[model samples]
Target: MAGQRGTRVAGADLVDLLTRAQRALVRDLGTVLEEEGCTVDQWRVLRALAAEERSMGELAAALEIPHPTLTRVVDALVDSALLYRTQSEEDRRRVSVHVSPLGRTKLNRLESLAAAHERALATRIGPETVTRLTDLLRDLP
Candidate 1:
């Protein structure tokens, strides 16, 4: 059956719904990230670097971002002084990236914002449902 007066379709696939939900969620919760002057991809890099320094390849793999795309994001962050790159002492050809103090500060802010966003979502969807949804997402192929 369709929604309301049967004006909406009922056979939408999971992938379609998931993608639309993701876009909407991102749009809804992206305020903090924007205020920090960082894109979601850049925020991911910052979060990763907050843990420890990493090589470009390692970062790309960890974030599941394409190498070329990661390179552009890293370049922008580096230019913004949020991240810096250094050559490996043992392997001059290899370069590693680390988050600067500014990056860490921004990351902390973004983390707080993310927590609030999650809380608001939990309130909207119910905490138990959020947990179950998270578990389901994690288990997806």
Candidate 2:
């Protein structure tokens, strides 16, 4: 019983550490993204759609965003002309979102900025450490 309690406490500590690290990383990256007039969530959506179009549900699942919040994000992007929605020809009710040319240009710029931010992080923490940490995180269930 005592051993199980210790393991639970250690698990909680790991969760807290991971959350804090994620928040710090996101906060720093958010500053870089802000220069391009983008938020982290918006950037995530754009990045996900960069390779191919996806239905709202697929995007929500891929990005771990709630459907309603994803809808608002898609609406804002559509209003900005960064993305467009098309109803499936065979399934009228099914709509998929695609990035516009302008959105691609913006995404390119954002990608550059993000790359630089990652490079800076690697430099600060040592590239080897960053690689190891990334691998370790990926190994987590």
Candidate 3:
């Protein structure tokens, strides 16, 4: 019983540490994206489209953003020529979005940038820390 209590306390502390670490990392990534003239939210959309085409609702849900907010992000990406919208054949009102060639190129660039950042993090935190942190985060609720 005592051992279990200690373990729970340690787990809670680890969660707090992970939360702060994630916030810092995301904030830095946001800065990097802003330098590239896009928000983290917008980059998320680009990343989503890079994988496959999806409707506005699907993209919104995948990104965990509201429909109205997602609409603005989609519009911005569309204006930047990174995404395009098309009507579904089965449902004319259902608009499917796909990443444009330019968007794909940008997505690849972002991936490269992320790799560079990951390497830097590896140097700072060691690969083992990253591996464990990743596993822990994946298991987090």
Candidate 4:
């Protein structure tokens, strides 16, 4: 079934439906995250910083993100003290970011919220279908 622009209108595949849903989902989640005093970009930055210290370039690469935009997200997190960027002593030109205690706390809170949200969704959609959806999404190239 072709949609208005001749794109497939099928909803059986999760990706197409999910991609279309993201605009609204992002707005709703953005509102929720904002109410928690964070932005979507800030949340992503914090997640990236949580694993290990990374330079701006390294973080951008790990995120598959462009530099300048990611820099703005990093700047917000840095200024909030949720992340700290320190210059490498041996290489003054390079800087690395680490998550702070505050950042970890917030990230944990967000994780809990996400888990609860997932449970609720599973209840509505059936756990088996939800699990399949998650698996397919995880396997997507």
Winning candidate number (TM-score)? 2
lDDT of 2: 0.93
Of candidates 4 and 1, the better by lDDT: 1
Candidate 2's residue-wise lDDT over 68-100, tens digit each?
999998898889899999999999989999999
Models ranked on TM-score = 2, 1, 3, 4
Q: Which parts of model 3 are misplaced by more than 4 Å?
A: 1-18
Q: What's the lDDT for residue 25 in model 4?
A: 55
Tell me which residue pairs clash in candidate 4: none
Q: Candidate order by lDDT, highest to lowest?
A: 2, 1, 3, 4
RMSD for each model, in Å, please?
3.7, 2.9, 3.9, 3.4
Candidate number that wins on lDDT, 1 or 3: 1
Q: Roughly what TM-score does model 4 have, to 2 decimal places?
A: 0.78
Off by over 4 Å in 2: 1-8
Q: How many backbone clashes does candidate 2 have?
A: 0
Per-residue lDDT of candidate 1, residues 50-77 (tens digit): 9899999999999999999999999999
Candidate 3: Cα lDDT at 141: 69
TM-score, each model? 0.84, 0.91, 0.81, 0.78
Q: Which candidate should be chosen as best, given lDDT against the real structure? A: 2
Between candidates 2 and 4, the one scoring higher on TM-score is 2
**lDDT digits (tens) for residues 1-141 of candidate 4:** 346546644555666678776676566567667767887778777888888999999989887879999988888887888898899999999999999999899988776665666676678779999889789778977
TM-score of 1: 0.84
